[model samples]
Target: MIKNYDVIGDIHGHADALHRLLARLDYRERDGAHRHASRSVIFLGDFIDRGPEQVEVLRVVRAMAGAGTARAVMGNHEFNALGWATPDGAGGFLRSHSEKNEKQHAAFLAQIGEGSRGHHEALAWFASLPVWLDLGGLRIVHACWHAASQACLAATCLDSAGRFHGEGLRKAYRSGTPEHLAADVLLKGPEVRLPSGHSFRDKDGHTRHEARLRWWDREATTFRLAALGLEDRRSELLDDPVPAECRYEEAIPVMFGHYWLSGRPQLLSPTASCLDFSVAKGGVLTAYRWSGESVLSNDNLVWVAA
Candidate 1:
């Protein structure tokens, strides 16, 4: 069985950073795909949207994944791309082509051209990615790793191999469905609603009524302490108690991305790590070299300048 892995963070179309990181990890590009003698890559998705090189990033990742050198999970951006391209059985798409949505996806569409063969192929590949991976020794997901949320997907959306099928894709995007909630929590991290009259503007200037929870923080009890990736606005969050359901109590080493973390790449806890250093936002592309250690370490974190 494979024991060594290079768990990578969100790419967000930064192919240069990705290439640099792979080289830094000693992976060589061979036969149009990067591979290591004994190590494999676990890509934490978000391979498209924002930044330049969207198609290039997909090409490299798809080649490697296709050649069995890497495994990947679907990020929210990939999911959104599928929704944007899929018909809703009415006149509109699952994800509308509103100005805001288009603006967010402009870079990818500019590169791949909506409705092109490349776009359809990319969407098909995205549909094939698992929402999460449990490798017995370790687990990987794009965001939060909640058992109940995964169970929801297993029941309504994911096939035995964890990919979404036709009816599953439809239900996964439908509002008020268990599959929808599962997709949201797994791909975009779990969130906790703020107290009435409490809210904050996100990085995109959108007002948010809920804060992304630090689900891995098993000791956190209050919202103020449980908020993730919003250190600047933590004071504005209510000191209200965090719901018990938001806690992550598992012991398996889980490596995930999508938090847009900053600073030197590091483990969130002994068994939890967020590899995303916001490469799409002029930050680093981080990875962790795992050698089958049950407890993760900061020393294993490796990254390249963006």
Candidate 2:
């Protein structure tokens, strides 16, 4: 087990920024892999898509993880890649070859050469990544880290070796099933449908019907308060906080990425934090250096300019 960890946020194929962040963390490039003398990286994932150097990012990260200097959890992009590539047992892909999924993955495909041998190998590797990581003192997920969701995946999606592959993996991505919801909530965070007659344009200017909630705020009692942690536009969002029964109530030192947070970085809660700072969208790539602390501090946060 690694004694110290530099929990990194979503890279989204920003390899240059990832390298800069590693340099800031005192990691040195050695023997073709990034290494820190006494520390290892726990990547929160989203290493592909939306950036200019998708394949290079994969090369660097895969090399580090292969050298045992880093560990990574599967992010939503990686999961989507698997789903998009899998066979539906009929005619189409497991995720359905739609324009939406294709557009979302265009950047990645552009850099990696869609349907090339390298792309297929990368997708195969992505299929083997675990959806979450429990490192005793530190817990990491791409988005929300719910115990129930973790247990559900463990029982339904995980193989003996803890990989999300084969039948279980496909089942987890199949929409409308309990397995799908569990995986979605864990990978994409908890979301609630906007009330009838309510809608909002996201940061990308796409109209969103369902909104991702602030999973770290338990006392957000109004719409503005509840939307405090959302990464998208909030001006048109419903001014309604989620019910108390739906909020995250844990005090564990959990760290996740995926929210395209901007501006100054800080803990989402005393023990909960988001590592993503929207590096793919010209925001900085961030990381939270952790060493057995139950309560996190903003001082531990690090970043590299996008």
- Predicted structure with the largest lDDT when compared to the true one: 1
lDDT of model 1 at position 140:
94
- Measured against the true structure, the TM-scores of the candidates, in listed sequence, are 0.96, 0.92
Clash number for each model: 0, 2
lDDT of 2 at 69: 98
In model 2, the runs with Cα more than 4 Å from the true position are: 221-245
TM-score of model 1 relative to the true fold? Answer: 0.96
Which residue pairs does candidate 2 place in steric collision?
223-239, 223-240
Tens digits of lDDT, candidate 1, 189-253: 88888778977788899898888988898888888888875667777788888778778777789
Q: Which stretches of candidate 1 lie over 4 Å from their true place?
A: 229-236
- RMSD for each of the candidates: 1.4, 2.4
Q: How well does model 1 score by local distance difference test?
A: 0.90
